[model samples]
Target: MPSPNYFKPSHPPTIANVPELTPYYYDNSIRMSPMERAFFTKIAKKDKSGMVGGSDEAQFFRLLMHATGAKKALEVGVFRGSTTAYLAQGVGDGGKVIGLDITKDYLDEVDAEEFWAEMGVADRIEIRVGNAVDGMRKIYEDENGSGTFDFIFIDANKDDYDAYYEWALKLVKPGTGLIAVDNTLFHGAVLDKNHEEGRAIDTLNKKIHADERVESSMLCISDGVSILRKK
Candidate 1:
């Protein structure tokens, strides 16, 4: 069974109401609690990909890894390394996580080394720069020589999803391997019918469902995510 749908809000709440209910991500904009808030607040101040994954999304990585015992894991995006740290928390000590991204430098303003150290699981992550699909290929090669991965998170460019899906599947075992695709809901626009991202995701979701290699479920969480586990 897949996680409950939360991102595709039947009727999105208002931010200016008496209770001031903002969007799922909007609530994180304001910070408190000193260090934890400071870290997130710093990411919020940026306009670029400095902080990509919100807490809810990061928790997806953490919980899924925990549930799957994903010692050998892969992430197709590494913006600012915030999500990387979250995965590190899930696969700690003897476990390892491979994170890849196209960008060489993200949030260079922040102290990357110190932040991971503060998180205390810095040693388990390996970051690489290249096309995410290409990076997925490298992990396949690594596993061919070593062992298979337990899980993979696909949060790279949405346009290349089909290619990433093909490559990521090769790195894990069928029926046990887990894959999650980000931005599947495409911001409530999947209902719009004419929007580009929505149309593309709608088409892709159909293909994913029909594919014999996996059983998939789309969650309305943090931009419409889909979780797939090989059948």
Candidate 2:
């Protein structure tokens, strides 16, 4: 069973009172490629775990990559590679995306490599399956200490957020890289004291706010996305 505070609002009461979405907003704001649309449909049909982020979140990630001119990216949780596809699209043919997941089942289930090839980005992504912390370390070492990525997306296990943040800081470019973390709000469970996953997220949120190395903001976008730009 879930805790009572699982769905409680973390935002102020006034803000929480606002409608979740409006027709005007939905009609005018979102955009997706045909490939992206297909990916969404595929996930809807196959992904029963509900691990994928909404289209808005995926689009935001792509926008951030384009806005930053991110040529090299790292995605901590590849899930079904939906976000990876978006990242690849944002970076173009010359860029690359390094994806890490704890298991290969999701990647295989989604036929990620085949999809990337179909999208004309197979050469741009390298999928690694194992402990993300170890993978990040290997990546740092393999790049000869200079493979700093321009953008990073973290959406892995909530308990490892702090550890991931530490590695993300090390892997990202010192001044311009962006690190975006998904599920910081955890379905508003962050308000609950007893939820371990929520507590993990809440801890990372506080840490990011206090950390002087980055400028940060938490948006109410799908499940909440916390974006940090390194100083």
Candidate 3:
């Protein structure tokens, strides 16, 4: 159900972004698969920025897949294929995942082929390195206008999020399909309306909120996640 906005708050609601809260929450939450834990540990150790989604958020992707019983999924960004692994697992047996990335640099850095194989999901996933929009366009074209995906995840170039969402709407199954956009809040930048990416995300958030074709919500999760279901 969509969140109700019936009452106006007298005081501004406090948003939580404490550093210690992560460890505390992860400690009490459900444990990730051993492979997910190891791969995430590697990402956290080698990737200084920690841009990749954390275990809990990654698990949420898997949860979304299960919730919708998604058999075919698309991930728009494949940074080191960390979250891609979870997406692959989420699709269950005989399912497929298409991963699109702007470059193979990160995948090469991590030996993605061997990594996905080690994760036991190599055969079910396909990696496409190029412009994400073009890749999605090809998929839509190849699928003959009919929605070819049950789930689509967008975590690519923030500036192009609106474009990606437009394409995703065309590719995902109507009513049943789900589209998830990451970093919707952009580190709280959406609230301040600073920078190009933040402004882009803010615009999309508002558009999705008002868009009558889909039902959506912005979750206050890691960096903020927005889920949209086509009507």
Q: Return the top candidate by lDDT.
A: 2
Candidate 2 residue 199 Cα shift, in angstroms, is: 0.4
lDDT of 1 by residue, 1-231 (tens): 323654645544343233344454456643333544555666677776433766677777688889877787788887777777778877867988888888746735555546777777778888888888777776667547122777778877777878888887777667777888887766566677777766766777889979987888877556667888877
Best-matching candidate per TM-score: 3
The lDDT of each candidate is: 0.71, 0.84, 0.83
Per-candidate TM vs. native?
A: 0.79, 0.88, 0.90
Error of 1 at 180 (Å): 1.0
Candidate no. 1 TM-score: 0.79
- How well is each residue in 1-231 modelled by candidate 2, as lDDT tens digits? 544644754654433566654455556777766876777778778845577876788888888888878899999988888888888887887998889999879878877778778888889898889999889888778765343789899999899999999989888898888999999889988989899999999999988989998999988887799999888
Quality of model 2 by C-alpha lDDT: 0.84
Model 2 CA deviation exceeding 4 Å by range = 1-15, 20-24, 145-147
| Number of backbone collisions per candidate | 2, 0, 0
Kindly indicate the candidate among 1 and 3 with the higher lDDT. Answer: 3
